[model samples]
Target chain A: MTAVLRRPTAAAPRARGRRRMLPFSPRHIALIPIAFVFAVPLLQMFLAALSPSAELIQYPPPFIPSHLTLSGFQRLFAQSDILRWLGNTVIVSVVAIVSNLVLCSLAGYGFARLRFHGKNFGFFGILATIMIPTQVLMIPTFVMFASVGLTDTLGAAIVPWLASSFGVFLMRQFFLSLPAELEEAGLIDGCNRLQVFWRIVLPLAKPALATLAIFTLLGAWNDLVWPIIAINNPGAFTLQLGMANFQGVRRTDWALLMAGNVVATLPLVLFFVAAQKQFVATMTFSGLKG
Target chain B: MVTHTAVLRGSPSRARARRLGSAKRTVEGWGFVAPATILILGLSIFPAAWAFLLSLEKWNGFSTPTFLGGGNYAEIVGDQQFWDAFGHTALYVVLFVPASVLAGLVLALLLNGRIRFVGVYRTAIFVPFVVSPATTGILTNYLFDQQFGIVNHVLGVVGLPQQGWLTDRHQAMLVIAIMSLWGSAAFTTVIYLAALQDIPAELLEAAAIDGANRWQAFWKVVWPELAAVTVFVTIWQTVQATQLFDLVYTTTRGGPLNATETIVYYLWDTAFHQFQFGYGSAVAYVLFGGTLIVTLIFVLVSRRRSSEVI
Candidate 1:
């Protein structure tokens, strides 16, 4: 067993080095087609957004337009509150990211390092709620919000995004995986727990924090269901809510609908492209251990 | 306890100081957890408990709530619409979970090798997952439109007859399932890819030397390593399938004779649209209970299977 394990470690690097020299691999033939199939929808969305309205409504709609036009984009901007919706979405996402980082890290640190009464019970209680589907909670949550006069406001969207059980669990798991020695040393050096967390531990937790921020941002930015239930006020619509309503109202305007889709999706796609490494890392980490 | 005893052995004053420090530590711990604890309690635990209570009462969001004492749940049992929605959700899970997982596994296996442009391939596969389900739904609607869709155009190009996609009740759910798979298979792909990379190359080489073919080697080696992840993916996918709303809401609105009405969609339509909060709450609890039971069953079965293998 030991020899088998040792052989791989020794052989793996050299094999990789040899494989890198090949100009092309047979795998590309299969991969290229799969990648094209996967990429076509996004490509289509962009193309349709720029396609002429006549071409968009044509039978078996033209794959490529005779000439690209900005009319769809012009109409999207002029006809809807797309800009305000984008602004609201950004505000929601920013607030969610900040609050999740602060609250989840604090709670996670407490669970990971502090010895308090009911520590296990509290942690497990929060973790247990992760199994409860959000669908079950929406009605009562809406009722509660309505009773508080928070319905039809951005608060309904922002309030739930303020903190999450998964955020707390993720932070705690990351904290636990870290070495305790540095923290112990900080305590010995006369720093308070908060100071230690702020000055010493947080700097080390940047990667985990980034992962949390990314997930929170994505969730808040793309949220549609709750916003649909809560916010009917056109002024308070997030990008997704606005887009959904846009589609509903303009069922036949393919160009306008595609334009809205592009605007709503481009930011996230760009973010994913820029931070592809962290994006993949976050997904794998969450999927395997969440 | 050990610290207290140790300090007591050292000096009386030190023992008192240690107790004070521990008390301070406890306070600090509570301070750290208080904000998150309150939020979770208020948002999750309280709402869940409140939903259970509301399930037993009738309220239309404007008037006084009247207690029904399990009447709503009893009604749910006999309600054909609820059962129809349940059946639709079940069908969705059946269509979605296996196909997504299998597609993910295939994509992961393909991408895991010593390949060129691995990063590019990964991004292509993953971009759809990053796109919101609502956007995906809109894209699906246009792409699969009965009269003008690119899908029908492709069928025509291929010398096959064009078919109604989202419009046909027989094919609407299947279209939704395919769209969902397109958007979400990348999640499982990323997961399985991570697991695949962790498997040692020597094991496959050893199996090859032992005269095991690729299929035999995969079944005997790779499959076992992936069993736990498969369970996790299945349960997650099932939960997602049960909560299928955004796509349907965006595209079908449970349309063409209510063929695509899922539990959550039906629940939303009942409460928000029809003002049947009490009935909706009952539907919600049934969904919650069903999800919990299914998750538990998956865990238990996987546990027993793994133990038997051990």
Candidate 2:
């Protein structure tokens, strides 16, 4: 994990047409097949979704549909509670991103720069929690949620995610790497601690905040296990649970199910496109890759 | 938190003022950290402590849990289904960790070759990881549908035999593995790519100057530098493989004859579906024990190796 910290700040952009860096390079030829292997399943799913129902049932399931239609999506929204699911998912993700951004950074900045009682032990204790499997936590968490009347509510899903251990660790590390002179200047001006953090530190922490935001949003959006067990009400179900139920009920309907998948996944694709560089940087920097 | 240090280091101040300021920083530090600390300790450690109590009792979720000291653990040892699920998880870890790592390394190496439109290819590969696993399960289910799947269709078109994918109990775990591999390889590739980029060009240059082939250079120059990341990725993958629930939950529900039942899925089944709360907590503890053992062993081995190198 420490190795990831030494990651180069800026990767060298590939120098195209550099007079063949490798001898007898057949890179594209090799890559084309592997990329095709990686891409075709996703493309095939989209094609299946766009195809008419009868066409999808044909043998040798058409890789390229004869005609594209919105019928699959139309059926998904018209027949299932997909829009409700989308709304619930959006609310959950938005709340998660906002709360994590606020809480993790506040705590993270404290741990990073503050000299206080039990600071090292406190931070290390949180870091150690990262190793505990979510599975181990599931049973007791569900029991507690049930006892507290949180089960079957969006709160059950949102609460555990509010301030992830990793989020704090990442923010703390980011803060540590920041130049301290700026904060010292604010301190020298007779500003209180919280004011310095707000006025000087946080504004400078935008890149770290953005990175944390992206990761949290992605996790909350794509989460399944906790939501499935914790939130049983169809009304409270997130997009993943809604999609899972849709598959469970209509596994045979390839077109409609594929459409639901696309509905569930398309936003992530668009989001990734908008934030590719950050995603790449975070993925590289997040030593907790699992 | 940020105030005291700056003030203390500034030009001489009254002892009383400095002491007050120091105390203020301590209060502020606690204020900033308390919320997250309380939340984590409450949600994480608190539940874990209570779970130990739950593990000691035998009860359905509804009725009062009955104390059965040491009984749940005894039952687990004799439970054939538990052993089978444990075996399934072990097999999965053995197959998946290596397959994903290799596939990732191969992809990263290829991308590192600087093919045209590298960003496009990398994004296409990585997009799967961002898609929810439950959704990935559905996509793969549709892709591997027994009769209408694109996989069998392509195989048939290529004049090959079409094989049963998600059906025929034997192939269920394999199908799940393929889906996991697809998503996990994307993550592993990104990690490997970063590690690969960090390897010194001079090392590869040295290897090539010695007339080593690409394969030779990779084995001698690249792999050594990547050993640390490799250990991390393998351990990461192993832990993840053990908790293989989401994809399996949506896809197999632990399967035809329970052939695909991994430990976490079994734990979920026992606790949530069957409502055997005490036994489920017991299983959770066992899963924790297994994970701790694996992690401790890896940590020990890695520490020893690093010590030897130093």
Candidate 3:
């Protein structure tokens, strides 16, 4: 991950481009206002989540509160299933991250390295699934899960996410980038394909695997629609869906809802901060490929 | 939760197993792919076919589906709300797609070269992308709330009137567009940055040495390479924007005279809200067709462009 943050050796080329750069250059003194404009909404969200509920709703709208309090957090804890939702989210994310790392890496290794029959055809078939929107499948999936008696279960919530084609593709691409010599050496040393994958390729592919795991965790943590549709029981509700229940038709508790939002979003922000370097490079790469 | 089977080539425990290697390989392939294939088919493909069939029926979910033979499709064609939803989706694409792509392109260009803290900026911008649209939907509701929203507060500070961003029908879609913009622009920027890196520096330098300006070189050389990325983003944005329901459901529920009501939201309201499953199926198919057409156009254009480059 730190490798992504280190400046490239091609500084001379960048300097040449910089010499003729337009107003959009990174060094442009003019971009400050635009950057500030983009930053305000996020700043406001953070501030509003911290502000006292009454001050937030005041007519003049206190920009900066005199007394900052955790009353909203208290209200959220008292009113909603914040903890249970968090637990559910954690369970879902962990399962998804673990399964994606193991299964996707195995599958990706097979696709990238194996000489199995119908490999190309099978891979393309998987890619075709990307075109199908989830909405078109929602009702049928619900019916199928209900028939299997898996409805409202965490199994149902976590399974579809584990079959992430994007993860498979990312891992496969990384595996392709890896040298074949290590795996070949392992194979010659009487290790089987699965063993070679587990022992050799998997260790070498740590950066890519970590990237996939983080992405899966983030996705599962933030997902709302699938859980909402699959689970009718409140016990199974993930944080996002549970937080959405804040908008009860009769009354609006702005402070508590914002606080819940903060709680739900804060961990991800922390995670991003911790993994910022890897996250950016991986994001940059994933965008290009998919 | 299927366990990994003992390998025919490797497992000593299964050494005496009589299963033919060919048969075993075939079975293993299917087994490995089974969970994904079944889930996708059951949840996605089968439901899509069922939705198509249901579109011909006239049934609320409570009653048995009656074969009305295109009645639902006919009704959808004439329904003003269906068209309104289509119009709103189109309007959303018209406003959002370009803004997001341009924002993405500019940001990518800005962050393309070496900078000391480019990673921090990238992560900060991309943070919103990881946020569930549901959260964005809810957060934006508070942010754009006319009476107490931070948006209105900022506008008031600038001496502008506080607008009812989510309530006013005319303004509701714009709010949705802005939220969509915020979430999607990061992704586009990420994609564009990748594409920019893939461009050969020698070609760029050659153009620069030939006295062509940076803008000209970008237009002539960079945009062509970025074409594939652009097409990918547009098609994705179209599919997502067309099927947008989460944000709409959370923000406005298609209220304020059904102004912000998109096709999927309308379908949800009709199916789950009104229990008109047949009508909902019809609307779903219509959105599907819309997506298919848009996707086809993108594919055709990209194919042509790639061929031209070849």
In the range A1-290, model 1's lDDT, one tens digit per residue, is 11211232311222422345445765687889999989999999999999888887787678888899989999999999999999999999999999999999999999998997778888988987887778888888898889898899899889999988888888998999999999888877878788999999999999899989888887898899889889999988999988988888888788888999999999999999888877877787667555
Arrange candidates by TM-score, highest first: which order?
1, 2, 3
Docking class of 1: medium
Q: List the residue pairs that clash in candidate 3.
A: none
Ranking by DockQ: 1, 2, 3
TM-score on alpha carbons, each prediction: 0.93, 0.92, 0.88
Cα lDDT of all candidates, in order? 0.86, 0.82, 0.74
lDDT of 2 by residue, A1-290 (tens): 12332343212223323466565456677777777777776787788789898888887677788899989989898889999989988998999999888889989999999887778877877877877778778888987889899999999889888888878888898899999999888877878778988998999889888888888887899999889889989889888988988787887878899888888888988888777778777777665533
Number of the top candidate by DockQ? Answer: 1
lDDT of 3 by residue, A1-290 (tens): 24532434211145563564454454445345555555555666677667788787678777677777788788778878889989988998998888888767766776777655666776776666666776666655665677787788876678667767777778888999999998788877878666777788888898898788877877788887677677778888888878776565313566677777788888887887787766766676655454
Model 3 Cα displacement at B55 (Å)? 3.4
- Per-candidate chain B TM: 0.93, 0.90, 0.89
Q: Write the per-residue lDDT of candidate 2 for residues B1-310, one digit (tens) a residue.
A: 3454556665666576678777877788878887787787778877887888899999887788899998999999999999999998888887788999888888877777444577777777877778789888998788888898888888898999988877767888888888889876788898888888777666766666687766776777788788888888888888889889888888878887888899888999898889988999899998888888988899889979978966
Return the top candidate by lDDT.
1
Give candidate 3's error at residue A102 in angstroms: 2.7
Q: What fnat does each of the candidate structures reach?
A: 0.65, 0.59, 0.28
* Interface RMSD for all numbered candidates: 4.6, 4.2, 3.8
Give candidate 3's total backbone clashes: 0
* Model 3 spans with C-alpha error above 4 angstroms: A1-27, A115-121, A152-156, A179-181, A249-252, A285-290, B1-19, B28-32, B59-63, B302-310
